[model samples]
Target: MLDQLSYKDKNTFLQNVHTAAILTYLAALLLLPLILAHPLYLLGVFLIGILAVVVSDAAQECLPFLVMGIWVAVFVMILNPLLVQNGTTVLFYGPELPVIGRLRITLEAICYGATMGVRLMAIILAFALYNAIVHPDKVTGLFSRFAWKSSLVVSLATRMIPSTARDLSNAREVQQMRGVNFSSGGFRERLKKYSWLLEVLLLSSLEGSLATAEAMQARGFGSRRRTCYNRELVRPRDYLCFLSGLSALIIGVYARFAGYANFSYYPQLDTLAAASDLIWLGVIILCLLLPLILSWGWKHWPYLRSKI
Candidate 1:
């Protein structure tokens, strides 16, 4: 993510795809895990998002986020089983703690943890893909017309995360050279070591904020009326991408109302007895893949690019 964005020089399909279409595509990607709790469905979407990162040639830019997501999800998965004692299928009856009584790990609890982890992974992938393909300026321009402040905030956040991560990494390395072992001790010891890292990160963030404020003031951010120098143009295939995203959203809402996407792991995992979700899943996949498919097609076929 710290790598300079090279999306423009590539002349890939994503750069040509409409921003509205991409946002809608992302909307569908983000909508699934919120309303549905099934792990397989969520995993399917997450895998496809990874494919998107690969196809968009953003592996370098997006992989750190993917790795970070995996770490967080794994932490959640491991932590959930230790805390929740719901479910009949006993996996492990852990030791008693002071405040939290006996730790009873069950199959249902594990499944629920896995489901939650996968849901988070899917969400992270969606944001990573957005950061990879969509230009920050594009996002700023797209939403600025309706919600300038919101767009500005979103744009800054999207741009800031990678930089902040890079800063944290550098700070860690510098501390290591100074004999600060971030990974060599027990949990509490390591936590104390990180205090210095956190301090450095906080200072770096403040410096970045100051720089941003200065730059914005120099740009006349609040001096006068704003103008969009680079407006997006919606093309024919762009409409198709937009429509596909809207269709996925409709299908998802319908599935939610019909209870096709609902799953529970408390009593036990829900039986995969119904095939109704298959049809909706197919629609969702198509809608999810449409922009990517079109982009791939346009890139491979010069004639199609002329028309799309």
Candidate 2:
């Protein structure tokens, strides 16, 4: 069942999406604040990047909820500049509200929010790619070695949401076929009508849970330690890929501290004029090109491969 929910090896579109998504997260984490001050700018970059990656991935299955989850996390955590609006300089006056009074939008707050947003987006995209590409069985197997009960619970819980959503959609279709009018109603009525669907879906899930528990108990599922298949091989390509990601992360951190890439909001000023920006930009370009460089080296030079 876990394997059935996992990405197939033939899903190159998913692989490409995963790659793009990962790169987008990494680059945005490393570059967004270097170039932009507004939280909206970071959000725009993330939206465009996600759209491009997912469209490129173009898998038959639609994971709209997962995508929505990403957005929800972003909006709640990173997009709310209101939480961190503190600086000596105020760039603009936000509209006055009854309880909040006139809000001040500071440059520092904007940059702060943008940075936070980029960081949150990075984590979300990385996990989203992992979920989209990596097999859940593989993840379960990996996690089980560390903590079996916790791993299984998390895996099951993660699987549960999608499964329930699928069941709900099917239930709605059946209700529609049975002459139930879901569309021609007020918002409250529409919601009230869906209660029937939700009830049945919950019942179905409860049954599934019972069946799964029974099947597991019968098989003595936890009596012995579970074994995992070694499907992921560590090739030279993987090492190069990992090293490149590491380099990007490190360079980003370095640039942040060194003032090559920075964010400031004080006395109504937001500028990045450090000399390190040029040097680090070159370093980032090299880091991004490392994969192609190593690939080319592998094909053309046999003796030079010792360094790789």
Q: What is the TM-score of each candidate against the true structure?
A: 0.75, 0.60
The sequence of per-residue lDDT tens digits that candidate 2 reaches over residues 62-125 is 2543465557656754445565557866777878767757777766666665556565564455
Q: Which ranges of candidate 2 are over 4 A from the true structure?
A: 1-10, 13-131, 182-196, 268-271, 288-308
Total clashing residue pairs per candidate? Answer: 0, 1
Please give the lDDT score at residue 60 for candidate 1. 81
lDDT of 1: 0.81
Relative to the unseen true structure, what is the C-alpha lDDT of residue 72 in candidate 2, on a scale of 0 to 100? 66
Tell me the tens digit of each residue's lDDT in model 1 across 153-255.
Answer: 8888877877888899999999989988777989999988999889999999999999999999999995778887777788988898889878877887887
Q: Indicate which candidate wins on lDDT.
A: 1
Q: Compute the lDDT of residue 145 as modeled in candidate 1.
A: 86
